[model samples]
Target: MDKIHLTFSQKIIVNVFRQVRIIKGNLVHQKYFFILKHEMQLSEFKYMIHDLGPYSYDLSGDVEYLLQNDILQKYDGQISVGNNILDKVDDIDLEEDEIEKKIAHISSFIQQLFDRTLVSEKNIELAGSILILLWDQEIYVKSEIWEKIKKWKPGFFSLIEFDSVWDILYHKKLISKEVYIPNNYIERLKCLNSGSKNAREYYRLIEKFFRYIFKNELNNFVLKEYWCDGNKKIDFSAENVAKKGIFKKMSKYSSSPINTIPILCKNQDRELFGSDLVESYELLNYEFSNIAFLTIRSFEHDQWILDEMTRFYRENDKKSIKKILFLLQDIDLIDMVEFRLRGIEPSGILKEKLRSVITNRNVVPCS
Candidate 1:
């Protein structure tokens, strides 16, 4: 028989099924495995950042073509290589001189991950998520990178134990060796939050704020300029589910959990303490998030703000998710970035302030 014709994406998909029979394989699995092409630049398909990580219609279309034409097949929710797998893989062997070495390396790695029961949508997506940020030159710190990935896919990572999977990928070298070290963090923060003129940029930097300071504690969605029915502008907001972090402990022990965290960014340093309290408190919808976060540089060591924090806590009132104002500051924006860059968890800083807040004492300064 003559050689079979295949599209670039078709050959790449075939190569994956050839090496391993992926159980529960589907489009998500296919797209993530296809990220292999992105790593080695094997395919020409371009992907946009989807909520589920990178996605490409070109790749999706080619997958449909291959399956419809029987170049690839899926049976019993198990995806394996087809009988006529890519005319011996020559078309996607990448460079003939390289002689399929890249695919070979990938197949071996996938097989190893499969053997160790590490191949899954989340694990592969984790690696791909890291690659995406590295490519954008957004972050290089491991802990910080992990935080950002969790923020992107919170619902997925929330219930899974993925630390072991990450160690294998990073410590064992599946991540690219060419690493980027960020140098503009301090200056970046200064420029973004310096004046009301840059408040828009500061709103954008709020995502950076969560990844840096919160460090996987809160899974946030940036909603700059989000408007309410009452027409008040919400500078930012986040998923109120506290991960297995300081906030989690607060939820478990204190029962004062927030539904959605509303964060507001300001231009000049003001004693934001309680200024927005009655407004934010009145703003809470009974069916939705019941708490708020106001951005401040430092918790002004005032007895009134201290009193405002304690006033909201009702030991027996589970319905009282409101008035739990968690104040974040500017120093944390810089300090936590450095902390996570060195692969440190910024939870200690959080714990310090939270402890003081819950105890209704003067909050510890972020150092």
Candidate 2:
């Protein structure tokens, strides 16, 4: 009789089965185990962003191989590596230094996942989904973390509580407090600095630049050729999620209803006058649409737009004054994003801009 040898991965698969009883042949535990392996720097498998969570084809292949080799055994709604196979691997006398350490950690972590009093599938789904976001979403803010989870899987939002999941992961030291830092500053700066002066290209570049820079600020703030408010079309509109950070501050100081703060974006043309922006203002008639951002490549119209913004604010009452217009130029946007990337809260930059628009004669360049 020849002794059987087990690959490193097969041994891990075996150990994961030994500690945790994955009910009903649920294959997701394989992916969960691999995540532990990846986090511990034990495996190099890549994961795809699946609806349920991160899925790995390579890990699937390993599981299939183990099953075919009879190393993995399944029976009666449970799966495990047979005792005979486990004994065979023991006879091989493989080094257990790292593998045992990882399996022990993994096995311990698995116990934290389920509530022993009752089994809930949603908790399992929440665990995997949260891991995927924490691993790849780069979301640091606590509120945004929950918002993103709800946005990704609204059905589970009822079951997934921030305090509950966060406490478990935080207490376990699996996660650390994080801060937001925007990326591709140089690339975006170049695009804003120099791009097709053509109106269409300018609009596209503006969208790309803003979206890339302030993505962490809020999700889905950019839209193209989007129509809303009585079917009146605008280049785009931004629904700023207030009640947090700078947006919250704006509401408190401005003494305005910041809920549903709609910032409108208008496609640009090299017009001599700021008349084109009037179309942007008109779109604010939509219920709760209060703010507007106009991206201009040519600073030639900066002063002109500034003057026009004042005229509109003055003619309108406080209700309309709260609905302000911001002039977003290349340099100003670069400055805003740069401040955020350099560990400055972007909300401060925005506050200054809105302050300048409200109090000072000059625009703060889109706060």
The candidate maximizing lDDT is: 1
User: In model 2, which runs have C-alpha deviations exceeding 4 angstroms?
Assistant: 1-5, 21-24, 86-98, 115-119, 159-163, 178-359, 362-367
TM-score of model 1 (CA atoms): 0.43
Instruction: Please provide, for model 2 over 115-173, each residue's C-alpha lDDT reduced to its tens digit, 9 standing for 90 to 100.
Output: 44113555555656666667666544444556777777676556335446655665555
Error of 1 at 157 (Å): 2.0
How do the predictions measure up, each by TM-score? Answer: 0.43, 0.47
Tens-digit per-residue lDDT, 223-264, candidate 1: 755556665363766665666775665456534455456676
**lDDT (Cα, 0-100) at 187 in candidate 2:** 40
Q: Any idea what lDDT model 2 has?
A: 0.57
Would you give me the overall lDDT of model 1? 0.58
- In model 2, residue pairs whose N, Cα or C atoms come closer than 3 Å (at least 3 residues apart or on different chains), thus clashing, are 350-367
Q: What lDDT score goes with residue 34 in model 2?
A: 44
- CA lDDT scores, all candidates in order: 0.58, 0.57
Give residue 53's error in model 2 in angstroms.
1.6
